[model samples]
Target: MNFLIASVSSEPSIDHAPFILSGVLLSLVVIYLASKIGGEISNRLGLPPVLGELLAGVIVGVSALKLLTFPESGSDGSDSVIMWLLQTTLGLPASEVSAVFTQVSDVVLLLSELGVIILLFEIGLESDLKQLLGVGAQAVVVAVIGVVLPFAAGTAGLIFLFGMAPIPAIFAGAALTATSIGITSRVLSELGKLTSKEGQIILGAAVTDDVLGIIVLAIVASLAKTGTVDLGNVIILIISAASFLVGALLLGQLVNKLYVSVATNLKTRGEIITPAFIFAFAMAYLGNAIHLEAILGSFTAGLILDESDERNELQKQVVPVADLLVPIFFVTVGAKTNIGVLNPLIPVNREGLIIAAFLIVVAIVGKVATGLGAFGQPGINRWAIGVGMIPRGEVGLVFAGIGSSSGVLSESLNAAIVIMVIITTFIAPPLLRVAFGISPDLESKELKTEVTKES
Candidate 1:
């Protein structure tokens, strides 16, 4: 028996109805509580909450305390507590129990996928296209350089140095291409410099980076599914993704207008938010239909609806739902990780560690090189802007998750990416402080001052 599964099998069987109710409740309680504690600790340590959540899952996962159990592949294993709960207590047939477990896993996966959609949509809702455009040539230059250099460096390094296969290498390179501006934005905001030229450029560039990253994600996922790469197919995929965004945006405007009109007349609950979610979900489905990631469509939906007066209310309603679901996704990503691969004593594990170290170096350098893209604007702190873009955070994790799910990244490579994410996230706050010559205390004071001024 797989030790992990066997450990869970010691639980006593209960009545069918109670077993399911208690099992689900107990599992979620453990996941939520553990993730929460971990995130709190991480935040106290100046690390990203996602880091803590991931670690929490690892602590409770198969490779560790085995508090949570997933069914093992093939036979030669005892049923896990989860499996036994369904099969023995629930009196499900062996095959039905297996099917039920798969369904349970699928539900978790689907919820995580939905969390991604909601996250992208929230990002879109917060984005101001006019302001992004106003940042002008500097933003465009930074975004382009940021995307291209990191991508080229990551792909080339993986291919040449690590001898990674082309397809997986491309996925790795693409993972390096996105910058999670949220971390940088938060730090800049704390420093009372959100409106500074450097800050605006970083914000604009990060937005542009997000757009490009989603498109690249679509392209890579399509490539993975097709198992081949060709110019024609690539062009088609690009066009399909673009067209889906355009069409969804145009149609979504009409949908929003109709929703508003009907809601104003009907005076029903969830009028604005309900339609917003419907449109987002519909667009996400449409994106998947066209072989694009659902986030592209959901994000575009947010962009479109944001053009209306209903945006604030939509955001207000969505935030609560997002708060509840998003953490689940991050925790699941962590749970799926096999941290055993991080051990350097094992040969393959050591290789992964080396690759991770190299990727971290590449991730930092590539973004730093993007500071050069701020060329014409000599007054701006170009290097500071580069440092600002360095933390990949949630975006990198999302890409890694997608790559793993799609089979485009092996376990070793996934672990490397995760390590890169953790280190970058941990370091970026202090690095940004140093780059900008601001102390933590000064940053806090500045933030408080700004808040008072605003008030």
Candidate 2:
């Protein structure tokens, strides 16, 4: 009887494994399908692709029918099996099987980071060094105002609302200082203003703003962990960033020269393309080792390769990998977001929604102030420049993630940040169209010509 009972216990049963696998697979399918459908709908409605992707995430995540769920601990054997399947796919270890669905969440965050890097690289590739130089002064003024105002406003807001938590509030304010160039670039591109003087200034200013934002994030992160901010470390970070740019610029010149030399003798396209990705990845790794954001390294790499003869070929090769990795990031970000955590009945809970509103306002008003910095420039609408800088997209989420992981931001704060990101991104394209006077049936030829002249 004991032997028979042991045999019965050992018998495998078709349990929850299948359901878990199906749910994860369906989630990916849904995200992809949503991307396709959303892209079409967004373009037709004169909106950015990111807005569509976020809408899709909201639909699949919590706004529409809720298909995904974070399973409770001590689930049955079938639940364990399902969780195991998701963990396996996400390459998460068995130890974290209890939070199996979070694996999908991690992937999305990873992709979002990857997306911003590629987006920056593409912007670098498309930029004309001479044009950027010509607009350098204006860009500097705009970038400075853009960073300072937001930092001040956000910090003050956090202090007034959350009280005197120096570290958390500082970090939260730092998060708000970022201007996502991706959203701005998309709106400008769509409005046929990408090559305009104002567009060039906004683009260049954005690059500057991002570099400053990363430094602030690093300092804030360090302060949060160490309980004090080191002035020496902050100075070192600034020097390092300046050195990175100077080194990249010098290296880019050398690479351009070498490419010109080798272009005549090159046998295959792969020879040029392969080394580019190797360099890009290597720079990214180096950035991480130096305690800087990895995307900063990738962006720097693109800037170094900007004027190379092989730049186009390299961009082509790198773009495909970027495309695949990017969506995974977005989908994973969506999965990690637990909308159920928000409770309208609780006062602390209500604080999140209120904070979200405040952030959206800060994000909008901060960029708009950049237009004032462009005050003296002729034929350039300062309002349009500020409007272009409105969308936060992946970069804002990245800040939120860093804050949350570092314990600078609570779970409620992270959710509020996500909502702010989505709202700002959704509003940008339409506002940009209105600002730039772009018609629904605007042709690419006109935009292309404008872009060429700007370059």
Candidate 3:
């Protein structure tokens, strides 16, 4: 049986440092086992392995086994079964359980965050910068329409259909506008469509969507907190996000010219890969400091490094690191999700589930229409473009989490948003693969062309 864990913010007992270390390692053991087993199962079933990894997280997480949980999202506790097991095996004192759980979960969360940065960097490395530039205009169109459609549709539907308050309806609508770049990019790379016209449009739009979504988030969150929107802050965010992307790209161009020479002279074991990480991490740090996503910075770093003579070598070396880290990210996103909100057996949950149904419809249809935004691309996979933008993933959760914590959302409304995120994030991968199922020869030719260019 699963347990709902309440959290306390306190320092770990120094005396139980060994027990804390054991807890973290144990959690990682669960994570790795779940990820690999789930991924392999999905691969065998002809679905994206990331899907299996996510489902495996759901199995081990709050929805099923209760083995993996996050207290910061308003659930999980120190006295849960994991803590009990640690106490039984490690002789950890009851007084130290909360601190240990917090420490271990915090470490795991950090690792998950690191995993995504590496994943985005790897994606950036694989992307054709020139191709991405070519589709930049279509991407902007896709991003704006993708955001406006979902936000407008969701907000209106809730207000008209369910009589939800304007503030809460807006927050839920805001959740729909996000596209998970990590998830979409991973699927594209696996499909060998990273260089295809459709793939480029998807990647560009997802990045653009994230920036615009963040701005929308700021506006909604501000609306939730204070009745009036801070026009000034919104303007600053717009300018800051634009400048960061442009500055990072321009700066990376200059820095990368010297980077190849610097790596050539280094004699250490990690000469090439080590310095690449240093650069990626620095950019990631700056991005976070400026309120932009860290993954954005890392992705930019990958794009910059991709231009170097050592690009192939960098890709080869980065894989081992990505293999070690990226699954953690996918798993944790699933693990943190509390799917209990959709329980049909409970009377109170039925209403939220019904609203979730509406949100889900809007989320899927609104994003699918975004494929049409890629205008003038003859014979392109419009459905694939739409599917690529479908998964709200972590970005949607961020919106739901903020809305819930800030008291702007009712219990039913919050539950509906979470369910919308879970479903959209889960369904998009397989749908994307199927959408790209044109004639086998043509698809294979596209892959071959991209491979030749990358090689």
**Candidate with best TM-score:** 1
Reference-based TM-score, model 3: 0.77
Output the better candidate (2/3) by lDDT.
Answer: 3
lDDT per residue, candidate 3, 1-455, as tens digits?
12223224445426757877888788888899999999999778755576678778878887788787766545545635677789899888887777788877888888887987897788678766665566577998999999999999999999899898888888899999988787788888988988888888899888778757765775576567664446786677667766776777777667777788888999989889998999999988977777656666787788789888889998999999999988887777667666687688999778788999999999999999999998986667788899899998766766765575567876567667767876887788889889888523346677899999999
lDDT of 2 at 431: 83
Q: Of 1 and 3, which scores higher on lDDT?
A: 3
lDDT of each: 0.77, 0.66, 0.79
Better of 1 and 2 by TM-score: 1
Worst 10 residues of 3 by lDDT: 1-10
Candidate 3, residue 156: Cα displacement in angstroms equals 5.5
Q: Which ten residues in a row have the lowest lDDT in candidate 1?
A: 71-80
Q: Tell me model 1's lDDT, rounded to 2 decimals.
A: 0.77
Clashing pairs in 2: 16-78, 108-329, 108-332, 108-333, 111-329
What's the residue-level lDDT of 76 in candidate 1?
A: 18
For model 1, the stretches where C-alpha displacement exceeds 4 angstroms are: 1-23, 69-100, 250-256, 438-455
For 365-434, candidate 1 gives per-residue lDDT tens digits of 9998888898776456787889888988888888887887787787778878877887788788888878
> RMSD of each candidate?
7.4, 7.7, 7.9
